[model samples]
Target: MRLLPAALSAAVLGAVLATGACGAASADPRVDAPVPAAQVAPAAQAAPAAPAAAQEVLPQRQAAAPPRPVSSGGASRAPVSDPGMDAAADGLRPFLLTPAEIGPEFTAGEEPRPDPATPAPCGGPGVVAQFPFAVRVGAAAESANGLVQETVSVYGDEAGAAEAYRASVAGMSCSEGRVDGRPAVIAPAEDLRADLGHDEATGWRIGGAGFDVVMISVREGEVVMNFTVLAAEDGLPALPDPLTVAKAGTQKLLG
Candidate 1:
């Protein structure tokens, strides 16, 4: 995704810092700022509407087949049931939702599955999921002077997955660990900016700037999904928290 350049003259910088400090306390950093009138490219389009939920099937006994007619005068016919076709169809049903329909909000740029023939990405080894929501953002590095690239993944969950994700993200700056045991890394945004100066364009405000980046993951049955937000930093002025806005956007997915 492309980052748009916001006007950041000295006057704007001073106002941003003053306002940003007050924004630090809010749940989302972006909320304080008016939602930009211009259409910022959405990380991705809203997902398409989902198909109607599948209907439940009841158990039933198979009927016995009648004997076949003699070949000499019989009409040609084919069996209605095919186990192989049924299995293939069943395998593909879960992945039918398009990426937009899979989540409330997501980033752009879908990766090509290792196997193009299959709709799903490669499963098993190094596979985060048959399908996963991937969002990318540019954040400040440890110095706060430069930018770093980060990717967040949303996945299907089982048990202990949410806690595990939190722990994994917590260990990111200090340890070599991965989200869901896949090779990845994370660093606290505040810690990254400890020494460097803040810039409005990069979305880092110094001193009174109270922004916080939080990692959130939710688990429902078999789905474990993760996302991040920059929260409103309290003690400042009117800047909105980025995290809070992100959370509000993703919360719709739970419904």
Candidate 2:
């Protein structure tokens, strides 16, 4: 929900980005896309070969597009372009988890750019409110673990970051709040907590009728990072270890 405040990642890159993988799990974690997995082998009778004229040469050369930061579910297209967001980004870039840190298979999104959609935040006026500026960077990945997503917000100082962190954790009590942009209910997941000696660590299992999201957030200095694993309700399995996501994120930041 937007109540997530400054922590949104490409709207769902923060939440919805997990949709594709989670949808697959809840629907059928089967290999539906790999043709060989679902399709039967060719029939006993072979088709006649086409005339030689039917064959055509394929293009030998083509213009190459710029490489993307990520290839799959992560939208993380936005970068910190504005001075405010850039300031926050500059202060925390070293601490950001690289795509490799996010996952061995994870690809990055576009290079840093502005995210105007994320404006002033309110925890009642939240995390972003405590700082002159804040930075947000996010990426997504699909692993055997589940649909994993990460969104981080960097404030100006530890005091502001801590205040924002507290406000965000407290926001969990709201019976209804916007997620991405839609309204959803909030609930505690009652799962593992991060314990890497960060000044603060907490988690939440939150979602509504159609989906469930489990997230763990830890603050190291001015940086507050959250790693979330989620699924849709249809065939939703018992939520996986939010600790896995949390620790991965913490290690990325710490290392």
Candidate 3:
């Protein structure tokens, strides 16, 4: 598993404060804005999307190209039945650390509902899910530290995953919009690297007012994974670095 790590340093944190990027919107920024016709799943309990168009407008690199098969050695390559996608979630749980590992104040939240049409914090739209099955773990933010969420999707073949990865990389460029009803500015995560190993990966920082959200998207083999963290700008306890979380996730998924 080739994984690029996104490390947060003091200089990066200082820059974020100076920019005042994606702060919460006041009374909602653009109520008249056309919601993506696809209708995003309400983020009520899910991780909110980054500020950018809900639909991906960038030209994806050869989306139809098939992903190269991962070197599986001599093992047989037989796909197994995954009813209701529970097996997929079970496979990913080991990659993410528990609340106890993060801190005593943290508590686990319910599994996130599948959001088919929401824009990803680092990636654009729901391109990650090329096949019908996907699973998500919602944000767990009972603690004052911050909120964290992750989603994983299995593509039927490598091409879908490759396409999704291409879209995510394209989103690294900056864009402004109202995400989940709040004003936001999304741009490349220059402070933290997005390419955490493997074929394709990218990161983004969506900042606003006194709050900030960081996201990383990675594609390994036939899997597309996303990790996001949101925290208050100042005060309270220090939040977990989203890059570390994403690295760990890709390691587990690809190793």
Ordering by lDDT: 3, 2, 1
Expressed as tens digits, the lDDT of each residue in 1-255 for candidate 3 is 222233333345445435655544333211110000001121211122221221121111223111110100000011133444454455445554566655576666433344334343333443322223333332233244455555555555667556645654553454553344344455544433434676656666554333455656666666666665555433112556666676765564455
Worst 10 residues of 3 by lDDT: 67-76
lDDT by residue (tens digit), candidate 2, 1-255: 322212222234335333422221121110000000001111111111111111111111122111111001111222333765444444444554565665575444322222333221111433333332455655444433234555666555778667766655654544444343333444442323334457776655444333445556667777666665544422124333456556766675554
- Each model's lDDT comes to 0.21, 0.39, 0.41
Q: All candidates' TM-scores?
A: 0.24, 0.52, 0.58
Q: Which candidate is the best by lDDT?
A: 3
Model 2 lDDT vs. the true structure? 0.39
Candidate 3 root-mean-square deviation in Å? 13.4
Q: What residue runs in model 3 are displaced by over 4 Å at the alpha carbon? A: 1-84, 117-125, 128-142, 170-172, 189-195, 234-237
Question: Candidate 2: TM-score?
Answer: 0.52
Residues 87-126, model 1: lDDT tens digits: 4323322322232332333222221111111111001222
- lDDT for position 119 in model 1: 14
Q: For model 1, what is the alpha-carbon lDDT of residue 113?
A: 15
